[model samples]
Target chain A: MRTSITRNRILTVLALAGFVVFLVYAQTNWDAYRLRILNLCAVYTIFAVTFNLIYGYTGQFSLGHAGFAAIGAYAAALLTMSPEQKAANFFLAPIIPLLRDVEWPFLPALLVGGTLAALASLLIGWPALRLRGDYLAIATLGFSEIIRVLFVNWQRITNGSLGLKGIPDHTNVYWSWGAALVTIFVVKRLVDSSYGRALRAVRDDEVAAQALGVRLFTHKMMAFMLSSFFVGVAGGLMANLISTIDPKVFMFFLTYQIVGITVMGGMSSLTGSLVAAVLYTVFLEVLRPIESPFDLGPLHIPGIPGMRMVLFSTLLLLVILFYRQGLFGQREFSWDGLLNTLARLHRRVTGLWGRTPPPSTVEKGEQ
Target chain B: MSRKKVLLVWLTLSLLLSLVAAGPVAGQEDEIVIGVYEPMTGPQAAGGELTMQGVYLAHEVRPEVLGRPIRLVLVDNRSDKAESATAVQRLIEQEGAVAIIGSYGSSNSMAGGEVAERAGVPVMGCSPTNPLVTEGKDYYFRACFIDPFQGRVMAKYAVEELGVEKVAIIQDVAQDYSVGLAAFFREAFIELTGDAKGIVAFTAYQTGDQDFTAQLASVMAKNPDAIYAPGYFGDGALLARQAREMGYQGYILGADAWEAPELIEIGGSAAEGILITSHYHPEAELSPASQPFVELFMEKYGERPSAFAALGYDAYMLVVDAIERAGTDDPKAIRDAMAETKDYEAVTGTITLDKNGDAVKDAVILKVEDGEFKYVGTVKP
Candidate 1:
C-alpha cells in the first residue's frame, strides 16, 4: 500500500506535467477557432468540477448553477467593460452609475464575480437547503429563472435583454485552463478533507450523520458556496472568451446541459467530471461537421441543422442506459489502476480472458 | 464493483471513435465563400428558416459574381450568443469566407458583430432590426430598416391613420429586438401624441412565454386605445389570441418580427386586423426586382415569401453586387464596395446604405386579413 501511494504520487506529478505540456502545445499551435474551442473546454471543465463538488460528492441536486453563473458573468462583465463600451451598450437605459465607469483588469473582475456568486449561493443555500431531493431541484430551478428574469428586467445593471458585448478578449488557453486547474485542485482538496467526508456522510445518511453531530446545513452551504464560486469564475471566463452575454445565455437549459454532463461523468468522481467536460465540449465541435453540407462520392448531403444535437442526445441516452451509476461512480484514477487495466487488456488480447485477474483485485488492493 | 469506473473508459472510447469518424473534410477550392451564421435550430428557428429561404432564393437567382461561383458556408448559430461569435470565427479562419450574411435575431447579429469586426470580414444582417447590430461596428451592415426608423413609422401610422391616443406597450423583455423596438415605439408615440402619458401601460414578458394573461390583464386595466406588442411571431400570435380571447377590442400593433405566416396560422381569426411595420409584402412588390423574386419564391417553394425572406434575398444580392462592383472577392475590397452601395434595386426596395451601414429604405405596413398579410402602404424613410 505504501509503495502504491508513492507510485500514485509520482504519476500525479507526471500527469500534471503532461497537462502543462499539452497546454503549451495547444497555445502555440492551435488557430483562433481551435483555441477558442479548447478554452471553452477548460471553462466547462470548471463548471462540471464545481457542480460535481456539490451535486456529485455532497449529494445536493442543486440546479442553481446557471443562476450563479449569471451573477458571475454580469458582475465580471460590468466591472471589466470600459466606460465607452458600457455607454455604447446602455443606449436604452444607462447602466447604474456605479458600474458604468469602473474598469478593472480580468483577474480581479473574475475574482469579484466568483465572490458575488459565492455570496449569492450562501443566500440561496440558507433557505433552499432545508428542502431535499426533488423539492431542492425545483427550488434551484426557480432560482435560476428568477435570476434570468431579474437580469432581463434590471436593464440598468444587465443592459436588459440587449446584453453586454465587446468584452475584452482576455481569456486564452492559459487563463481558461489555469482557472480550470485551480478549480479541480480546490475541489479535490475540499472533497478529500474532513469537511468533504462529513458532506459525503450527509449524502449517505442524513439521519445518521445528524445523529453523529454533523451540522447538515452548514456543511451543505460550504460545498454549495465553494462550487458556486468556481462556477461564477467559469462564467466570467466564458463571457470574456465569447465576448458577449445576455440574460438568455444563462437560461435553465445551461443548467440542464451541465447536469447531463455530470450525470454522464460519474456522480462522485472528480476525474469523471473532468473527462465529461472535455468529451462534451470537444465532441460537440468534432461532431459539428456532420451538420454542414458535404459531398460524398457522387451524392451531396445538404447540411442538416440540429442533427448533431440529436446524435449527441442519443449518445447521452445510451450512456445513461448502459451505465446507470455513471462513468466513474466513486472511483478515482491512479497510476496503478490504469497500468493494471492496460495489462489486463493486453493479457486478454494475447491469452485467455479467465487468466486475467478479476476486477475486484484493485478494489481489494485499494482497501 | 459497479462498472461506474468504466464510464471513463467508455467515454474515452466513444470520443476517440467519433474523432476518427469525423475526420477532417476537405476544404472548398477556387470559390468565393460567403459564410452564413443563422439560428437554423432552436427557439428562433422559424425566423431563421424564413431568412434562409430568402437567402437561398437569392442565391438561386444569381449563382455567381465576378466570374466566380459563390459558395455559401452556412453555420447554425443555434440562436445562442456565444455560438454566434464562434460561428463567425470558424467561417473566417477555417472557411476563408470573403463575406457573411446572417442572423435573423438582433442579439445573434450583435454577438457575431465583434468577431467579424476583429477579423475584418463584413457581415450583412438579413432582418435584425436593432440599430445596435450595426451601430458602432464598421464590418456589420444590414438589409432592412432599423428599429428606430420602423418604430417611428409605426407611431406615425398609429396617430395619423389609427388615431390611437392611449397606447400600451408589451414587449418580450428577453429579446433585444423586441425591447429596443418597444422602447423606440414608446418614445415616438409619446412624441407624436404630445402627451406625457401617451403610453398608458408598459408590461413585459420573457420570450417563449405561452401565457400572457398576467401581462394582458394589466394592459386591459389601463384600457389603452392601442397595444404595441412587437415580439417574434410565435409569441405575438399567442399574445394576440389571448388578448382577443380576453375581449380587448383595441388595435394590436406589431413590428417586423410579426411578418411570418405562422402568426396568422397560429392566431387564426384573432390574428385578423393585426397591424405591423414591415419591409415587403409579397403582393406589394416595389421594384422590378420584386416580381421575379415573389414568382421565383412561389415557384420554388409553392408558398408566399415572408418579409424576412425578402430582406434576406436583398442581403444576399447586395453582397454579390458589392463583390461585382468591387472587382474582387477580397474581403476588404468587398467591404469597401458595400459601404458605397447606393440605390441598389432590391426585392424589398431601393436600398442605399447610410454612413452607419444601415439601409436607407422604405417601410411597409401590413395587416393580417383572411389568413394572409395584406399590404396597406409604404412608409418612406
Candidate 2:
C-alpha cells in the first residue's frame, strides 16, 4: 500500500510538471503558424498513439489509418461548413436532412465525424479482422488507395480531389492537446485493465486466449473501433488546422510516416511515441536552414535542393538498422528514476566534500 | 560542495548571458535578399525546377538590384501547403528576404501569401494563376493572368476557333489549378455555347497516377467533339498518348503547365496537334525585351524557353523593377511600386497589373507539331 501510494504521487508530480512545461512553451510561442504546427503535432500524437494501440498493443498490422482520417476530415469539413458554402464548392450537399441544413459547430462536427469513422471501421473491420498480419496490411493498404481514388473521383461529394478548402481554423493547441491528454489518460487506463490483458493474451496466442474464455473477436473489434475513433478525431483536427483536405494528403506515404514514427519510438510505449514525434518535427525544422549552401571563406558550395529527403531517409534507415527495437523500446520514463538520479548526484557531490549521507534515507524520502 | 554548486550556477548563468548577448544585429546591409519558395521536390519538381531556372537566369543576367548585389535564397516547400507556410516564415524571419517569388501551384502560393502578408513581405508569384492569391491581400502579387481569364480564353478557342460543340474534361482533381481552371472553363464553355449541358462527361484523376485506362474507357463511351485536360505536362502527355492509343481522335486542350520538353518526349507522335493556352512563346517574336532573352535562353539551355521559364524571368524582372522604382528594399514600398506597374515589357508580352494584382496580358496559344510546340496566335485578354 505504501509503494502504491508513492507511485501515485510520482505519477501526479510528473503529470503536473509536464502540464506546466507545455503551458510555458505554448504561451511563449504565441505565433499562429507555430501554434498551428504544435496543434498538428498534437493531432499526430493522437494518431500515433491510437495507431500504436492496434499495431503495437493488439498486434494488428493495418495501414488504412490515413484513409479513415481522410473520411473523418471530409465528414467534419462538410458537416461544419455553412450549407451555402457546401453547395457552392461541392455542388452535392449532404442528403441527410439533419446534416443538410445544419451548420454544426466545430466540436459536434468533430464528434460526429469520429463516430462516422468508427462506423466505417466497423464495416471494414468485420471482413478485415478475419485476416492476419501481412494479409491484413495489404488489405488495409488497398482500402486506403480505394478511399483516395473515391475521393478523387467522387467530385460531387469530395469536390473530386480539388480538396475541401476554406475549412474553419478552430483547431487550437488547447483543443488538440486537451484531446491528446485525454487520449493518453484513457488509453493508459484501458491498457492497465482486464480487457487489455485479454487483448494481450489474444496477441500472444489467439487460440489459447480463445480457450481461456477470452472473446477474441469482440476484444479485437473493440480495440479496432476505439483506435479508429481517436484517429478520426485526429483527422478532424488536422483538416481544421490545414484548412484543406486533399486526397493526396492521405496517401500511402502518410501511412508510411506514421509507421516510421511508431517504429522509431517503440511500438508499445506511449512516452516513446510522444518523444519521437517532438524529436522528428524538431529535427526537420532545424535541418531547414542547413539546406542552403554555406559561404565559408574561400569556398562556395552550391545548394542541393534534393538533399533534405536523402538525409531524412538515411537517418531513418540508420535508426531502423541499429535500433530495431526502437530508441526507448517498451520502457516508459519514470519520475522516480529521474529523482533518484538527481539525489545520487547530490550525494556524490556532498561525499566528495567529506560529508556522506545515507542513500536509504534519501530513497525512502523520494518514495 | 558549496563551491561546486556556485561554479555550476555561474556556468549556467554565463551560457544564458551569452545567448542573450548574441541577440539581434542592428541592420542587414551588403545584399538584397529575395526568397524563392517552390516545390523543388515531389510530383511538381519538374515545373518548380524550370521556374527556378528562369529566376536564376534573371539573376545571372543582372545580379544587382538598386545598385546592390541580389541574393536569391531558394527554399524547397516539398509541394505541401503547411511546409510552404513554414518556408515563407523562415525566409521572412531568418533570411531577412526583402521580397518572395514563388510557389508555382495555386495552393502553395496561397499558403505562402498568408505568411508573407502577415510578415509584411511582398510575395510575387511566378506561375500561380489563381485570382484569390491577390484578391484582397495587399502584399500578394502575380505575373500571370488568373484562371478565370485563362479558362475563358481557352474555352473561346475550343468553341469558336476549333469549332467544338461538346467537350469532355479529364482533370487532375488534386490540383487546385486544374480544378479551378476546369470549373471556369466549364462555366465559360456553357455560356459561350448557350447550353447548360455542353459538356458530355467530366472525369477526374489524381496526381502521380500513371494508368488512365479506366478513366479513358468511361470518357470514350461519351463521344465528345473535344477533350479538355488541364493538368501537368507529365500526366497530360500520358493521357494524350493513352487516349490516342484508344483511338480518340478528338481535339485535346491543355493549359500552360503542359508546355514542357518532356511532354513531347513522353507523348511522342501522340502529342501532335494538341493545343495549349500559355502566357509565353519563344517563337512569338514579341519585342526588343524578348529577343535577347529568347536568344540567350536557347544559347544557354540548348532549347527554347517554356512558358514557366519565361514567367520566372518576368517575375524576377518585375520584382527588381519594383525595387528600383521604390528606391529601397522595404517590402511595403516595393509592393506599392509593384501595384503601380503598367505596360511592363516582359519577354512573355506587355504586362499590366490590374486592380486584383493579376497581369492583364495577351494569352499565347500553342500547338504541338513535328515534335515541337509551334506558336499559333495570341488572344488578347
Candidate 3:
C-alpha cells in the first residue's frame, strides 16, 4: 500500500513538472511556424501512441494507418470548409446536395472524421482479422493503396489529388497537445487495466487466450477500431495544421516512417513512443541544417545532400540490432526518481569535498 | 530498485544532454543567405538534384550578389508535403534567407509557398509549372510558364503543326503537375477541336508506378494520332518504351516535366520521334546569355544541361536581378522589382514577369531522335 502511494505521488509530480515545462517552452518559443511543427509533432504523437496500442500492445501489424488518416483528413476537410470555398475549389461541389449544404464546425467535424475512420477500420478489420503476419501486412498495404487510388480517381469527392486546399487553420498547440495528453492518459489507463491484460494475452497466445474465455476476434477488432479513432483524430489535426489534404500526403512512406519510430521506441511502451515522436521530429529538424556539405576554413567538403536519411536509417538499424528494447522500454519517468538522482550526484560531490550536502539535497536523497 | 534508479538517472542525463546539443547559428552580416528547399531525396530527387546543381553552380560562378557573398542553404523536403512546409518555415525563420528557391514538384512548391507567403519571403520556383503557385499569392513566383499556357501551346502544336486530329492522355494521377497539365491540355485540345469529344481516350497511372502495360494497352486500343503523357521523365520514358514495345506507332508527346537526360537514356531507340514541350534547349541559342550559361554548365557538370537546370539558373538570376534592382532585401520591394522585370537575359530565355508573377517566356519544342533532343523551334505562348 505504501509503495503504491509513493508511486502515485511520483507520477503526479512528474506529470505536473512535465506540464509546467511544456507550458513554459511552448509560450516562450511559440511562433506560427514553430507552433505549426509542434502541432505536427503532437498529431504524430497521437498517431504513434494509438498505433502502438494495437501494433505494439496487441501485436497486430497494420500498414493501413495512412489510409485511415486519409479518410479522416478528407472527411474533416470536406466537412469544415465553407460552402463557398468548396464551390470555388471544386467544380463538382454543387452536384452533391448533402456535401454542398454540409459545413460542420471544426470539433464536430473532427469527431465525425474519427467516427468515419473507426467505421472504416471495423469494416476492413472484419475480414482482415482472419489473416496473419505477412498476409495481413499485404492486405493492409493493398487497402491503403486502394484508398489512395480511389482518392485520386474520385475527383468529385477528393478533388483528384489536385488536393483540397483552403482548409480552416484551427489546429493549435493547445488543441493538439491537449488531445495527445488525454489520449496518452486514457491509453495508459486502459493498458494497465484487466482489459489490456486480456488483449496482451491474446497477442501472446491466441489459442490459450481463447480457451481462457477471451473473445479473440472481438478484442482485436475493438483495439483496431479504437486505434483507428485516435489515428483519425490525428489526421483531422494534420489536415487543419497543413490546411490541405492530398493523396500524396498519405503515402506508404509515411506509414513506414511511423513504423520505424515505433520499432525504435520499443513496442508496447507509451512513454517510449512519445519520446520517440519528439526525438524523431527534433532530430530531423536539427540535422536538416547540418546535412549539407560545408566548408570550415581551408576545407571544402562537398555537400552530400541526402546523407541525412542514410544516417537516420543507419541509426534505426543500429537501434534495432543493439537496443531492441528501445530507450525507455515499458518504464516511464518519475519526478521522485529524478530528484533522487540529483540528490545522489550532490551527495557524491559533497563526499569528495568531505562535507554534508544541502538540506534540499539531503531531503531528496532520503526518498 | 537500484536498477530502476540507475535507469532513471540515465534517462535524466540523456534529457539534459539533449539540451546541451542545441547550438546557436552565428550569422555574418556580410554574407547573403538564399534558402533552396527541394525534394533532394525520394521520387523527385533526380529533378531536385538537377535544380540544386544548377543553383550551386550559379553560386560558385557568381558568389557575390549586391557586393555580398551569397550562401545557398539547401533543405530537403523528402518529397513530402508536410516536410516541404516545415522546410520553408526553417529557411525563413532560422536561416534568415532573403530569397528562397525551390520545390520542383507542384504540390511541394505549393506547400512551400504557404510558408513563404506567410513569412513574407519571395520564393522563386525552379520548375513548378502550376498556375496556382502564383495565382493569388504575391510572394510566390516561378521561372517557368504555368501549365495552362504550356498545355495550350502543346495543344496548338499538336493540332496546327503536327496536324494530329485525335489525342490521348496518360497522366500520373497522383501528381498535381501531371493532373493539372492534363486538365489544361484537355480543355485546350477540346476547345481547339471545337468538339467536347475530341480526345480519343484519357487514362492515368499513379506516380512511382513501374508497370505501364495496362495503361498503355488501354491507350493503344484507342489508336489516337498522338499520345500525351505529362509526367516526370523517368516514368514518361518508361511509358514510351513500353508503349512502343506494345506496338504503339502514334506520336508520343509530353509536357515540360519530360525534359530530362534520363528520358533519352532510358527510352533508348524507342525514344525516337517523341516530342516534348520544354522551356530551354541548349541547341536553341535564342540570346547571348544562353551560350555562356550552357558553356559554363557543361564545363562544370560535364554533361548536357536539362531544362530543370536551366530554369534553376534562371530562377537564381531573376532573384539576384530583383535584389540588385530593389537595392534592398525588403520582400515587398523585391516583389515589385520582380514584377518590373523585363527582358532579363536568363539562360532559359529573356524573361518578363507579368502582374500575376509568372514568367512571360517562349516555350521550346524538342524531339528525341537517335538519343538526342533536337530543337525544333520556339512557340511564343
Candidate 4:
C-alpha cells in the first residue's frame, strides 16, 4: 500500500512536470496563429468543464449558457473599452452616460463580469430550478433569446447590433490555461465534498433525495451559480482573444455547441472534457482545408463551404452511438488503474523473456 | 506504462509537427499577397458572392503592381462575426498578406476591423457602410460611402423627385446597417420637411422576420404617403408584397440593399415602382473608363453588375493603385498611400477618400421598372 501511494505521488509529479515543459516550449516556439489556437483550446476546456458541472453532476438541463456568456462578454467589453472607443463605436446613439467613462483593467473587469453573471444566474435559477426535464430546457432557451433581443435593442449600452470592437487583446496562454486549471481544481474539490454527493443524489433520484432531507433547490442553485461564474470568465477570455463581440456571437447555436462538448466528453469526467476540448478545438482549425480550396496533387476540387460542421457532426454522432457512456463514462483517471496495468505488463514481459512466472507468483511479487 | 507514455508522446509530437508543416511556408519574396474575406455561405452569401465576382474581375485586370505579381488569398467568413475575426487574423498572420479587403455585412466588417487594427494590418471594406467601421481606427478604411450620406441621398430623392410629404419607416432593428441608415434618413427627412410630424410612423422588425403584416398594419394606419423600408432583400421583398396587397399605394423607398436580382423575383410585379439609392446602376452613363468593366462583367456573368459588385471592383483597384504608389510591400507604407488617394478613376465613379477614409462620390438613384433597377439620376454627396 505504501509503495502504491508513493507511485501515485511520483506519477502526479511527472504529469505536472510534463505540463510545465509543454507550456515553456509553446511560449517560446509557437507563432501568433498557433498560439491563438492553443489559447482558444484552453478557454474551451474551461467552458466545457463548467458546463459539465451543471448538466452532469447537478442533473440540471440548462440552456442559457450563451445568455450568461453574452452578459459576461458585454460587461467585460464595456468595462474594458476606453471612453474614446465607447464614443466612437456608439456614434449612432452614443453610449449611456454611466458606462461611457467606466473602464477597468482586464483582470478586475473579468472578475466583475463573472460575479455579475453569477448573480444573474441566481436570479434566473430562482424560477428555473423548480421545473424539470424539457420544461426547464424551454424556459432557459427562452431566457437566452430574451437576452439576445434585449442586447440588440439596448443600443446605448451594447452599441446595438454593431457590437463592441477594439477590445484589448489580453488573452494569452498563461491566462487561459491558468483559468482552465483553476476551474478543474475547484470543480474537483466541490464534487468530492458532501454538497456534491447531495447534488448527485438529486440527479439520480430527485424525489428520493428530497425524502432524505436534501435541499434540492439550494443544491441546484449552488451548482448553477458556480458554473455560470466560470462560464462568464471563459466568455471574457474569448472576447479578449477574438478582440470583438456582438449579440449575434452568442446565438442559441453557441449553447448547442457547449451541450455537444459536454455530451461528447463524459459529463461526469473533467479529464474527458479537457481531452475533448483540446481535440475539438485543434481539429476545427486543422480541418479548415476541407472547407477551403486546396490543391491535392492534380485533383482540383472546389471546397464545400460548410463542410466542416457536417463532418464534425458526423464524427460526434459516431462517438455517441459507439460509446453509450461517453469517452470515460463516470470514471476518472486513477493511479490504481495505471499501476495495475503496469504490473500486468511487467509480468508478461518477464514471462516472455525467461522462465514463465505463474499468475499467483506474479501477484505475490507485486505485493 | 512508461512505453505507452513514450508512444503517446511520439504520436502527439508527430501530430504537432504535421500541423506546423501544414502552416504557411516561405515562398518567393517577390509575390505580394493580398487577402480578401467574404461570406461564402449563410444569410448574406448573395451580397458576398457579388462582391467577390467584382474583386476577381478587377484582379484579372491588374494582377501586377510594382513589377511584382499580386497573389489574392480569399477566405470565407461564413457570415459569422467570430469567423470573420479569425479569417482576418489568418489572412494577416498565417497567410502573410500585406493588405486586406472584405466583408459585406457591417457587423462582420466591424469584427474584422478589430483584428486588423490590433495587428496593425490595413483592411479596406467594399460595401460595409457603417460609419463606426472606420471611425477612430487608423488601420481600417472603406471604398463605399457611409450610411449617413446614403440616407441623405435617398431622403432628398424622396422629398424632391418623388414629392413625398409624410412618410413611415420600417427598419430591421437587429441589423446595424438598417437601424443606422433608418435613423439618419429620419433625421434628414424631418429636416427637409421642417416638421416633427413629417415622419408619421416608425416600426421595427428583427432580421429573418417573414410575416410583416402586423408591422405593416400599424404602419398603414398612420396614412403616410411613403414607406421607407431599409432592410435586406429577403425582408424587403416580403414587406413590399405585403404592403402593396394591404392597399397602401405610396411609393416604397429603400437603400442600396435592394439592388439584387432576387428582389425582383421575390417581390415580382409588386416591386415595380419601388425607388432605391444605389452605388451604381447599369444604365447610368458616368465615367467612360468603366465601360469596358461593365461589358466584361455582363459577358462573363450573363447579368448586369450590382452595386456591391461595382464597389468590390473599385475597392480592389484602389488597393492595387495604393500598392503601386507605395512602391514597397510594407503594410504601413501601403496604408499611407491608400489614405493619400485622390480622384482615382474607378468603375463606380471617380474615387477620392475624405478625411474619414470614406469615398466622397455620387449616390445613384434608381427606380424599379419592368423587373429591373433603371437609372434615374445621380446625387452628389
- TM per prediction: 0.94, 0.87, 0.91, 0.91
Residue range A1-367, candidate 3, lDDT tens digits: 5886688677787876898688668857787657767777788788889888888788788888999999888889899988876776674223266787688888899898889999988888999977877887889888888888898888888888778766777787777887798889888887778889988998888889999999989888988998898888888988888776789899888798888787788788787788889878876775664465555446654566776566566567656655768766655555555666787778878789765544442122112
Residue-wise C-alpha lDDT for candidate 2, range B91-132, written one tens digit per residue = 887678899999888777866776787679998898988655
Candidate ranking (lDDT, best to worst): 1, 4, 3, 2
Whole-model lDDT values for every prediction? 0.87, 0.80, 0.81, 0.84
The DockQ leader among the candidates is 1
Pairs of residues clashing in candidate 2: A155-A160, A161-B173
Q: Which 10 successive residues of model 3 chain B have the least lDDT summed?
A: B17-26
The global Cα lDDT (0 to 1) of model 2 is 0.80
Docking quality (DockQ) for each candidate:
0.48, 0.23, 0.33, 0.37
Ranking of models by DockQ? 1, 4, 3, 2
Task: State the lDDT of candidate 4 residue by residue for A1-367, as single tens digits.
Answer: 8988788779878987898789778978987667877888898898889888988898988999999888888888889988987887887788889998988998988888899889988988999999997888998889888989999999998988878887877888888888899899899889879998998999999999999999999999999999999888988988888877888888898898788877878878787788888877776666665665544456555556666666566667666766566666676777776566678779878777766544342111111
- Candidate 2 chain A, which ten residues in sequence have the lowest lDDT sum? A358-367
- Tell me the docking grade of candidate 1: acceptable
lDDT of 1 by residue, B141-172 (tens): 99988988988999999999998999999988
Q: Using alpha carbons, what is the TM-score of model 2?
A: 0.87
Model 2: CA > 4 A from native: A1-4, A7-11, A14-18, A21-25, A28-33, A79-105, A296-298, A340-367, B1-32, B66-69, B130-138, B195-198, B204-224, B299-302, B327-330
- Stronger candidate by DockQ (2 vs 4): 4
lDDT for model 1: 0.87
Best by TM-score: 1
Task: Give the CA lDDT, 0 to 100, for residue B253 in model 3.
Answer: 96
